[model samples]
Target: MSNLQNGFLLDDETELKTLLFEGEQDHLTPSTSRLLLESDFFVVAGRIIGHSFLNGGPCLVGLSQGIIHVLFGGEPETATVTESDCADQDVREVIRMLQGTKDLSEEEKSVVLSLTLPWDLPGVTVNNRHWLQEKILLHAVLERTAQQVKQIRRGLKDTGVWEFFSSRPDAVPVLFPRASEAEITPQMVIDNINWPKDEDIDEDILSLDDHCLIMSFLRRFIENGTSDILKSLLTFWTGWGVVCSNLEVEVIDCSLPQSSTCFLTLKLSKNHKNYEDFHQDLMASISSAYSGFGQI
Candidate 1:
């Protein structure tokens, strides 16, 4: 007011350009803005979320609204140019209608594509403008994937379907595990599995009851397990190949990241006389196996 006679301040296009072109701030913010050309419907990849101080500099954000919108250097202002105001009438308008900016259509796209000297023009490079475009696309795709996974988890929770690993350290149920387990009392083991003295042959020592019980247990495991786990089990069950090199076991997880692993339990009867000793031995074996000091 004091420097100028009129209220109108001096317009300094040079200063405005300088400020707008100033580089982004890396640490304080994390939002990305790759301007996109709007289609009939909003494609999820074409939107910016959050706010970031981009120390990365004023990138020529890709097409949006069939126009160019340049974000100023860390400022709220974004320079805009509409398709009507563009230089060419035969811009790829038809091609854009058929294919989104995900494909190429210069007439319909706001940004230009060129490979000449000083190639940093706003409208150039159909698919490859800034690395930020891919980042944005990947971010959106991953977000959708995560959402779908959450939905699946909710569905699984509503029903009683989840993992049923053989052995896990901190075994807990993500969802109610299918009831494939039964109490193995000492009497059952003795009556069904015990064999006559000095019976070393597998055929001679086998018991029908024990075999059937094991089969029933496996059925439960397959029924409750994931498709992948079930396939693996079937593959092994079919005797794909029998090799004795090292004892190995795999406990697969088929649930959400936030949820707990599948339920699992197999041991001597809790009320058995040797339960304490058996528990001690089992615990030791588990600990040692994890520590790489023991084998199955």
Candidate 2:
């Protein structure tokens, strides 16, 4: 039995810990963590997958003080996340170069010809002895990238941190932005984010593995309120794995047809910290919620 509080009351820390981490005690499987850390691609894959599973499930988890201290113990880093852009590049231009195909913009045709469909141009003919082998090589490369992405995400969900954050959306501060201007603009800052995005988060973000930690630290004060869930997310404890340079939460309103769209902007530090400091931020944020409710 561990001394801790959950929501509006006290709960055993050991029990909650058991519920969350006990499964790992049985035995260690193939050690994939080492491999995941070795590459940027794998890290990004984990972030996307973690966000998917966490967002797909309920929004809360039981955390303990000890873990909280370890997870959030660090200075906040300032980091920004944005989407990859390929909107303007015409598909036809790419085809013209690759196989001299006349038609472009055929997402179906483009993908197929780019991968499986073979062409018989001046020197390159599908009937050529090595043509089929070339196609196979290209397909293999694409498949590996796709497969790696899937595995990275799967690993994130298995970590349990994803589950903790997903359950407590309110605690973590969420924001969404809609396209409004002729030119694309970032939608919401973290303080203003009210919803999650359709696409999964970057794999690198989840690599930090920061979640459920906030609840663990402030279990005594949270007691069973929406604020507890919020605390679990925003409390700084969850940013451990990412190298955060700064942290900020602000709210802003915009005037546009998509005005209702909300955005949540967050900047995290890049370095990892000990558990003790993480707890202070978690508790402070939860306490500030009631005392400084609208100040954020």
Candidate 3:
């Protein structure tokens, strides 16, 4: 499921050409390419998303909300379409112009007509400006890719979970979470850790200086890192981008960091000289783990 999602939807390679969907990071909508429609790629994508959710795997995050709404049987006209939902800059600009109260110039009218002409939509006029605006929004968000969206619905039905999805409106967000909802926070990471408790240490003394320093560095790094960096780290630690519960951290006798994904344990070397050394080793270890290098 992860491979399918990564390869088909989220991969950088697919962004160069329209295979199934369009848009950069997140905000993906169905493509209107006839070849893609004939290939039934979107149906396969829908199956991947449904099956992934059923198996406790990664959801198809970053899908356009308007598409999702229509996928779940909501009316295209009622589905919210904003400028951000329109991938084409020209169409988005025209959408903005229609949203405002000011009348367009003759040249601007020509541009609007030229853009909408491809969709067989009527020309914009004083009487039908608002109607044209709605039509343009629908065209960009739903009408252009209507067949692709229909195929996605067909694909969802193939998984047998379509009824489940249709019945429970709440599950839509869980199965197709927005990019922001899936974001990991520093506190989330910190709270999930099962901090080591040393029974041998005296009550008067706190944690060892080296342990304290390394832990502090870990927190600081997490707090300051970008979302991608954090996700990479999570993937390194848990063998998946999603965080697991009760991750155990151990300060042990080792030359480099190591993780046991099955046990959710992370072992860090206690011999770091300073933050620089720790950061260098940590990053190297994370890179190694991510690439499946230096694993037993």
lDDT of 2: 0.30
Q: Please provide TM-scores, in order, for all candidate models, with all chains considered together.
A: 0.19, 0.22, 0.79
> Candidate 1: what lDDT?
0.25
For model 1, residues 1-296, the per-residue Cα lDDT tens digits are 00110112225654321111011211011112222112201121111110000121111122221111111111112223232222222232322332344555565344333211222334435444444233222232222123322332333333322122113213322111112221122232223322223233234334444434433443344345453343222223222111111212211221110101121122221221233343343344333322232343
Model 1 lDDT, residue 71, Cα:
15
Clashes (N, CA, C under 3 Å) per candidate: 19, 50, 0
Candidate 1: minimum summed lDDT over ten consecutive residues — where? Answer: 48-57
Q: Where's the lowest-lDDT run of ten residues in candidate 3?
A: 1-10
Ranking by lDDT: 3, 2, 1
Report the error of model 1 at residue 272, Å. Answer: 15
Give the clashing pairs for model 3. Answer: none
lDDT of 2 by residue, 127-220 (tens): 4424443433323322223334344335455655545544553433221111121111122112233322224334344331332232232233
C-alpha-based local distance difference test score of model 3: 0.77
> Which ten residues in a row are the worst by lDDT in model 2?
79-88
Error of 2 at 9 (Å): 43
Error of 2 at 177 (Å): 10
